[model samples]
Structures are given as C-alpha cells and as structure tokens.
Target: MNILMMTNTYLPFVGGVERSVQIFTGEYRRLGHQVLIVAPSSSQQIPSDETGVLRVPAIQHFNGTDFSVPLPIPGILNAALKQFKPDIVHSHHPFIIGDSALRISAQLKIPIVFTFHTFYERYTHYVPGDSKALKKFVIALATGYANLCDFVFAPSLSVAVELRRRGVLSHMEIIPTGIETELFLNGDRRVARKWLGINEDVFVIGCVSRLAPEKNIDFLVLSVKKFLEKRRKVCFLLIGSGPCEDKIKANLKNEIIEGKVIMPGTVTSQPLIDCYHAMDLFVFASKTETQGLVITEAMASGVPVVALRASGVAEVIDDKKNGCIVENESCEDFVSAMNWVQGWGRKNNLKRNAINTASKYTKEICAQKALTVYEGLRRKNHILRNHSESTWETAKRLIKAEMDIIKNMTRATGMAITNK
Candidate 1:
C-alpha cells in the first residue's frame, strides 16, 4: 500500500500532530506498507536517513510561534505525485497543506482522509487581527473542509461529537494519537529521579507538553503552585519548552530556585519515559488538545492524572477510576482535583486502571485500525486515471473545488455569527 500523508507540522518539531504522523508512518512501514510524508521544510536538521519524506518550501516562525507557514509553489508536487502514485492522501490539518491535499485528491480522483486534530477557532490568536469572527470563520472553514474529504479522523469521541455538531457530515472515525506502551511500561522511576537529581521520596506532580499559552499553562502553573505550597515534600515537574517558559520561570521563581519546581525543557524518549514514571501524579490544564497524547503516555507509565475537562482529556480520564477530570476551569477546582488524586496516590487500583486505559491506545492498535480503514478506502478508490482528462470535466472539478472553499468561508461566517 502506498500512503501519502500531508501535514502542517512534522519533525524536527515535536507536537501531538507531528508525533501522530511519525507514529502512524513508522507503524505502516513496519507492517510492510510504503508511506511518504509531505510536510513543510524545516530549518532544523532533518534526519539524514529519511527516504520517503518530501519537504516543501516554508516561511519560518509565522506569528512568533514555532510553526512554519508553507509556501506551496505551483506544480511543486507534480513529479512526486506521478512517481509515488499514492493510493490515498491523509490530511492532518484544515489549512495550508490541507488545501494541497484537497487539490491533489481532486486532481488524482483518490480518497482523502482528514484528521480533525485541533479546534482551529481556539488558535486564532496566532493570526494577525484575531477576532471572534475569525475564530468562527476558522471553525466553519474546518467543518467545510472535513465535508470535502472522503473521510475524517477524530482523535477522541469528544472531538467527533463536536465536529458532528458543527456540521461535519463526512464519514468519521475516532482514531486517537497513540503512545509507545513498551517504553513507558519498563521505565525506571528510580533511575529517572536519580537522573533529575530528585529523591524518590518526593511527591512529583508532572505534565509533559509544549509549554504554550493555548495549553492554558498559566492556569496550570497557578493550580500546581498552590497545590505544592501546602505540601512540604512536593515537586512540580513541568516538562517541555515553549513561549510559556519565561512566564513559568517568573511565576514559580522562588519555588524553582528552592528546587521545588523543575522545568526540564523538552525531554523526549527515555528521559520522558523516566519523567512519567518518576511522578506520583500527572497534571494537565490544556483545553485545546484533540487527543492529549501525553496524558495517555503518563497513564502508560502507571501514573494517574488530574486534568481539566476538555475534548481529549475527558475521553482518557475515567473520573475517580484512573484519573480525576475537573468539570470547571477554576484554579481552585484544578488544585483540589490534584489534591484528590494525591490522596489516592497509586492506590485503589488507580495505577492499574491508568495502565488499562493506556493499553487500549498503544501505537500498534491505533495504527492497525487506521491501516484497515486505509485498505478498505483504497480498494474502493483504486482506479487508474486516464492519460488525458476531458478539459470540461477538469474545469468543472477545479471550479467546483474553488467554489466549495469560498462557500466554506461564507458558511463559516454565518456559523461564527450565529454562534456568537
């Protein structure tokens, strides 16, 4: 099987969407299928051994964020498309590369699957002239884009229901971003604590994610700080780095200097596995995550969690079973939830329940489910295009595609206005 995956972001950027692409691509290749990744070219060093990756030109650091704005030149992918002859195109975003996915799918008459990775409306802050209207516009645009695709992948049921509520009528499936279970399962808590120079006796409350504003880092830091102040032997282990680093440093300056707060910028692989195991409880406050991949990763390490009620977090947290899911966004509520989980510790089958939850979302399981869908969809769309397409039909399809996008914009405007 030849699979073409188009995403807005990819490695050497570490985020949920990038990790999802990486995990699925590796799994597909391991299962004896060919996968080609098409993403924006990064200034960072790409792996030298990569073969199936095609990087398009991009503008670096759009809006002071780590994201790259892709510049998709006309006919940039023409030659590769002819060579690869992808059976299906999977899009991980609703804009930029996502547009390319739509164009390519339409041109080649192949199946295109879109993953509703993020609620684009929540991220309008990155764009200049951010407004409620712009947010609503993006929401409608994403809903429209999902409808244009042959299928849609929702990372969680919360997201799936949300998309459906927003009018994404396309065939949809809940395929979560999975974690490598083996890595977390065999992690050495003692070793991780020793490496971080922390004693195993300390109660560590940790979270692993991109430290960005959209992640509600401010609320999380406040909650954790208050939670830690009451306990004499507690540590706040906030992993991952971003724009929020300086703010976190300032807010927890005294605690950090006193060694009560540890911010290890962007720890991955073994260190990340260790950090998860070294923790007594995992904490999250992001209201933006589609799958909350880190939450599951922590769970895989047998670390129960306390997270604010959000799309992905709610699905993963089983409320007093594996972890605590706060219903409101208040700092007090979040802190209280942490205390609640702290009381439970690794008891009352919490750790075992967390492990059970994580087991269901292993990389292998999610990938197999996706691969099965791809196989079925590919078989249904497996047809060779004619050497010469009719000019009228080509014109009609292209014009219609453009019109659909325009209509999406207008529809999104209406949706935004109505909701607002």
Candidate 2:
C-alpha cells in the first residue's frame, strides 16, 4: 500500500505529533508498505540523507511557533501525487496543509483520514486577539472540517469525547500513540545518571516536555518546590526546549542554583532512553496532552507517573495501579501524591503495573491497529465503487434487452397487418 502523510511539522522539530507520524510511518514501511511525507520546510536545514520526505516551500514561520506557513504550490503537490498515487492520504492537522490534503484527495478520488492530535482550544496562546472567541472558532472549524474526512482518529478517548462534545460528526476512533518500550526498559540508568552528574542516593523525579506555557511547566516547578520543603534528597529533571524555556528557567532560578533541578534542553536516541531509566518517578503537570507520550515512555522504563487527572492522562493512569492521578493541579495535592508514591515504591507494585500498562501500548500493537483501520477503510471504498459500477452495468444490460424486444414486436405486428 502507498500511504501519504501530510503533517504541519516533521523531524528536526521535536514534538508529540511529529514523533507519532515518524513511528507510524516507520512501522508501515517495516510491514512492506510504502510511505511518503509532505511537511513544511524547517528553519534548520533538513538532512540530505533522508528519503521519502518532501517539503513544501515555506513562505515564513507560522507566527513564532516552530510551525511554518507554506505557500502550498498546487503544481508541485499535483506532480507529487501524480507520481506516487497514494492509496490513501492521512493528515495530521486540520488546517494549513490539511486543506491541501483534502483538495488532493478530492482530485484523486481517494479517501482522506484526519487525526485529531491536539486540543486547539487550549493552544490559543499562540494566536493574537480575543483568545476565548478564537478558541471557540478554532474548535468549531477543526471539528467541522474533520467531519468531512473519510474517518477521524483521536490519540485518546478524552480527545475523542471532546471532539464529539464539540459537535464533531465524524467516525472517530481512540488510538494512543505507541512507544518503543524495550528501548527504555533496557537503557543503562547508571550511565544516564553519571553523564548528568546526578547522585545515586537522591530521589529523581523527572518530566520530558516542551518548556512552554501550554505545558504548565510552572506547576511542575511549584509542586517540586513543595515536595522539597520537607524532603532534602530529591532532584528534578525537566527535559526539552521551547519558546518559554527562558521564562521557566527564570522562575526556577533558585532551584537551579541550589543544584536541586536540571534542565537539559533536548536529548534523543540512547541518551533519551537512559534519562527515562534514571528517574525514580515521572511527574507530568500539563493538562493539555492528547495522550502524554512521555508518560507512556516513563512507564515503559519501569518508572511510575504522578499526574493531574485531566484530559488523556486520566485514560492512561489508574490511581495506585500504574501511577497516581491527583484530582487537581494544586501544589499540595501533587506533593501529597508524590509522597504517597514514594512510600508505595517500597512494594514495587506501581512499577510493575506501570510496565504492564506500557506493554499494552507498544509500537507494534499500535501500528497493527492503525493498519487495520486503514486497510478496512480502503477495502470498504473499493467494494462500494465496484458495487456501484456493477449495478450500473446490470441496469444498462436490462435496458438494452428491453429495447430489442420492443423493436422485434413492432416489426412482427407491422408484417402481420400488411399480410392481412
């Protein structure tokens, strides 16, 4: 099968959606399918070694975010589509490139699938003007357009429910993004700690996320501060970089100076795997994640999670089973939950459960499920088209037979009248 993925962002830019597309496409290729990517060109130069990745010419960066605004040249897109002839087109966003994807699907008469990857309402900070009204409009616009797609998939049930509540009339499915569990499970924690200069005796609580306002990094800092008030042997590692990196660091300056916190920008591959292994617990304070991919990664590494019981986090976390889910974002509640998990660590029950939960969401399982959906949609499309054509052919045959019979009857009646 030939699959075309149209996304707003891709590699060299690290984010949940970008990573998800990469993982899914990789799996599809391993299964003997062809995949093509269409994304905006990055500010940083793309690697020359990369293949099957096409970049649309970017006019400028979209606002100040890492995303770019592409000119969407129809000629280039048409040429690519004509050359590749994708079996189906899957779009990772609902705007920008999404419109181009829809147009291409229509011109080719192929099914288009859209994944509702983010809650646009929560990301109103990126846009200027009346945010509230803009959020409402964005939600309506996204859902309205998604309903027009062949199918819609949400990474979590929370997102699916929200889409439905917001009046998304599309056929929606819940498919969480998968992780490479064994990579995290097998990473060397000792090496990770030694490289980061973290002491072995200290309890490490970490989170991997973009340092942005939407992520609510301040909440994590405040909660960690509350935890450190009584516990002196605890350290925090905040990973990744984003627009609000300087602001978050400034807010946590005292903790940084005291050597109680480390912000190591972004680390990938083996280093990333090792970081997850070095953690005693994973803490997430963000209320905006569609699936909280980091939460699954940490759990896969045998580190339990303590997060706010909001959005998709609730779907993945079972209180005291795999991780602790605080009902609110209050610092006191987060601190209490952390303390409880710290005590619960002695039994190792949470760690076991965390691993178990993560096992259910491996990359292979997720890719297989997604492939099933894609194949099913494609099969249904083929069946419907064939059925329509078969019906039309049968109707034509019947009409022709009826016309011949009428002509024969007319000729016979005229001969009988002449003979009489």
Between which residue pairs do clashes occur in model 2?
none
Provide backbone clash counts, one per model.
Answer: 0, 0
Question: Once all C-alphas are superposed, what RMSD does model 1 give against the true structure?
Answer: 2.0
Candidate that scores best on TM-score: 1
TM for candidate 2 is: 0.89
TM-score on alpha carbons, each prediction = 0.95, 0.89
Best by lDDT: 1
Q: Name the lDDT value of residue 208 in candidate 1.
A: 91
Supply candidate 2's per-residue lDDT for 272.
90
The positional error of residue 213 in candidate 1, measured at the CA in angstroms, is 1.2
User: Which residue runs does candidate 1 get wrong by more than 4 Å?
Assistant: 255-257, 383-395, 413-420
Question: What digit string (tens of lDDT, one per residue) describes model 2 on residues 1-420?
Answer: 999999988888889999999999988999999999999888887788999999988855567777676676667877778789898999898776887777676555568899888888788787777445566666666766687688998899888888888778878788878888888789888999999899888888898999888888888878887786577778888889988888877766774337787889999999999999889989998888899999999899899899998788998899988879999779999999999888876257877889999998999999898888889888987766543456566666445534433443454345434522
